[model samples]
Target: MRLFIRLLLIPGIVGWLLGGCSEKIDPKPATYSQLLTGTDKKSWKIVSYQVLDNGNASSVIPAQSGLDACIADDILTFYADAEHKLEVSQNAIICYPNEPDIYVTDTWTLFNANASLEFYLPVLNGKFPWTIKNLTATVLTIEYYFPDINASYRFTFNSTTTK
Candidate 1:
């Protein structure tokens, strides 16, 4: 009886260990260029941008400290053709009715192999690299490395609420 019991237990344990080995993991990324720039062309807002240095969290800029009215109504729009735009609005108190709003158009791309984002700002001379932490229809999270500051900046975004 002991011998038979030992035989059954050995087979069961071996089968359990080898069961998952044959199954392969899919290498394709869940988030792609098509997903980032959806068909509807929805706009996204900067919900928050936090900087993590040595495991400490902090806001990137002074405006991010508080939802100052000056940069309150900022919106980002991304298109499928690798073009994006940032629309910035100033506080109504400071902005005159005839004052022109700020609109910045730039080129952006995603390297699917490494799951990183590259922004080619016309204003800037070089490309900015950002590793995508998470991406979805409603939210987008990215990490950027600032060599000068030696800190990793993470930016979180949420879909804008359209009127």
Candidate 2:
């Protein structure tokens, strides 16, 4: 009689303990800023850029006569402190390092809930505004609408340079 009662109590106690536990809590979603500058703080490179017109996206791959190979392999680094850098590997002394993995630093900032990505060239001659379309851990897609030209320039970048 005591053994039967013990078995019944054991099951109930086990169930009670299991029921008291809750499901694992998921990690909090990262903020817009954290999404750009990843936890590893790595640099990114532009995979492809397109100029859209009439809803059609045209590839702006810098393979034209004037654009060199190194120009196509630019890296962008964004920091949590609102400081950004554009490493123009084209100017490296080795001419073109195939994928242009050289070091250069420019400036960039996206602040105060504004989606404007004001990027200043290293030479400070020009600063372009690229609106943040989407930003993820692995991909960043921004667009520039030129009303003067009636064109929308969309640039897609990858977290790592696969070229």
Best candidate according to TM-score: 2
TM-score of each: 0.58, 0.61
* Model 2 Cα lDDT, one tens digit per residue, 44-156: 66666676987787756532222344544445566555445444444333444554354455666775376767774322236688798888778888887886776787767
lDDT of 2: 0.63
Task: Supply the TM-score for candidate 2.
Answer: 0.61
Over 4 Å off in model 1, which ranges?
1-31, 59-68, 82-102, 120-127, 161-163
Q: Which stretches of candidate 2 lie over 4 Å from their true place?
A: 1-26, 54-56, 59-67, 82-103, 112-114, 120-125, 161-163
